[model samples]
Target: MEDPIFSPPLHRQRHQFVIDFIKRNKPQKVLDLGCSECTLLKQLRFHREMELLVGLDIDGATLKKKMHGLAPMSTDYLQPSDDQLRIELYQGSVTQRDARLRGFDLVTSIELIEHLTLADVERFSEVVFGYMAPVAVIVSTPNFEFNILFPGKTGFRHYDHKFEWSRAEFKSWALKVCLDYGYEVEFTGVGEPPPGQQESVGFCSQIGVFHRLGGRAVCNMMFCDDAEDEFSYTLLYSKNYPSLHDNNILQRVLVTEVLSGAEKLRRKWAEETNGERDAADTQAEGDWEERHRASEQHLEMEEKQTDVFLLVEIPSSEVEISVNQMDCKTLQQAEQQRGFWRSIRKLRKKICFGLMAEDNRSLGKCVSVPLAVLWSGCPKVRALGGSLSNLRQLLMDHPGVTLSQDGSAVLLNDQEHEEEYDDLEDSGYAEARQCSHSVEPEEDWDANV
Candidate 1:
């Protein structure tokens, strides 16, 4: 994979250099110039922090063929997510000024300038630095000084290279570009130097990283009227992944996580209760009142069963404290499962969205999750300026979910009821539903596993 003279493949080293730069800077928008085969773009797509990614190249045929690799895979559809990473590809030369290419946070030209003729090289300098005016620019070229290390090589390293600048020549061009374009540059490169020539020569591929001067770092989106001429570049591919900011996508992702988590909690509580009734299963198919009373019976049975854990002679007040303590420990142990949320924390940590979700059959159909679990794993709801009230409203709107009378838990898979759930007339029924809502009331919602 590497050149005969290079130990670490030249292309791989260049890509790693760019990826590492991105990790440190965390740019939101990135544009790659001369993205042949788009291998870097493919790798960059995994970075969710980059909301907008665009790749440009003169090779239209190749760009069109390889860009589809950037599309969301099947698992992305199944297990919804909050991060909205959008990727686009265009067929155009880097020298041409496309309105869309301007204002990128990071612009990269890896081993590209050497392919252009001397005249086009000057145009590239003007277009990328003076016109596109990206906040930062990274340009790497073959180090002409390192060419002496290759035994049979002479003249330019590659057949297509119009010219390969030595370390001094590359620095001269980069410094001039910065001086004219209001940028400051730092020179660095990847790939090791020759065996005994560390100080004598630079890396096999020399790189120039330029940043815009203080106030010049902004992307002037309104740079000129030419920017409105959107046809300057042909868009080869475009895809916007699901984002929490988007209402429909957010609701689906949040509700799915909540419903699944709640179902697990209820099922787990039932199994450990040792023949205690399942509230959701025994819920009467008739009016809400019957379902409320049936749920009460289950709670009474659970309380009585757990009482066996305490001595028969305890006072009533002490007995209440003892039951509460036991219930808290039981729920704490159940929620300590493996990292579904670790990957799902979009605004919190960030979910890497490629794994298939568990099958619906295994999760079962008639699943209901308590509101506490739903509100805890609510999927960056607060990041979107939302509260529990807003989340409940979204779940209220979900087709498969039904909010119980007291707004305590969401019932799932039940047939749609036309009857208004506004407020019930019966006080006893409301209290029963409210009691069921407190299933794990004392557990901290903010602290998740």
Candidate 2:
């Protein structure tokens, strides 16, 4: 399907529900089944970390036609002119594509099965279930009751649809398939009838989630109904976390701890058992401790494997900032700090920190003045992050500060020069004057102030 300004009702509502599901549980891979023309695929903008999107359709020609219309994946010489929608669009019927479909974390069959023949339906169940990674599968089909209102209008059915069921009939069939196939079915999109429609035409859609014995749980479902009547429906299916205790990292951790503790108890029991053992079980006790110790150690390592840490780095600068504290002469760290603050003087974001002086003698002394203010009339801070002309404008804003001829130092309020920062120049026998460390506290140094 071409990217339409407005998505059909069923597809649009279904997309909203899927977006919400992704927000809560971000899956790494998504399989779109019977993805005709992939209209919704165009609108999806995943976070940079997302990987593995597969769009499957029964017709290779249709798939290529649609993908080419959108734009192909780009290489160095041939760039796609459209948005970088590098989806993996596979050509082949889902029933025939089992060899290509095995690892997806989510399999979404949206309003798809109704079009399949009964044989195709069974093949779909077997193939889709087999392809999933011991996880989950989502199946959605139109509600037959919904089809009643549009009788003979043929909405859910393409001229190709073989069968469509009403709400109860569909749910009954879902309940049977789930029970027989070990899937847990959930009904959705059913609600009060739209104001003036028949039960079949106005009734909402439904979805089901199937968990294979050894696969990850399925998490997405899309159901799209009629577009012309404005009564279409869409539904998304998201599974709650599954319980595979053997697969849970934390559970494995705790199990290892318990087994290690059990091994120790086993050793104590073995010693007791040995006192009464005959030759028959003597060899078992002889090697049991070593074996248990090794197993326990293995579990301990497994427990350690459960710990996860994530590190992310971005551009930032770290610098110390201080503020004068006159009331208490003792130097103290400020209790609060701003993560980001804008410096209008520099026209850039500045990382800020505040410290309260603790020494009574240093009370009322200016804490290290903010670089923004200290270099206010000078262009030093501003020029570092922007052009010289912009820096001159910034200097013009602050009246008293000035820069020396070489522009390496800043004169704060004309009292101190940037060269004053060079401690190495005065190292050889120059007695540094001790500025008065003693000063009275200013009245308003409290954090609230």
The whole-model C-alpha lDDT of candidate 1 against the native structure comes to 0.67
- For all predictions, the C-alpha RMSD in Å is 17.4, 29.8
Q: What is the lDDT of residue 395 in candidate 1?
A: 79
Model 2 reaches what TM-score against the true structure?
Answer: 0.41
Highest TM-score: which candidate? 1
Give the lDDT of residue 394 in candidate 2: 41
Give the 10-residue window scoring lowest on summed lDDT in candidate 1.
Answer: 347-356
Name the Cα RMSD for model 2: 29.8
> What clash count goes with each model?
3, 31
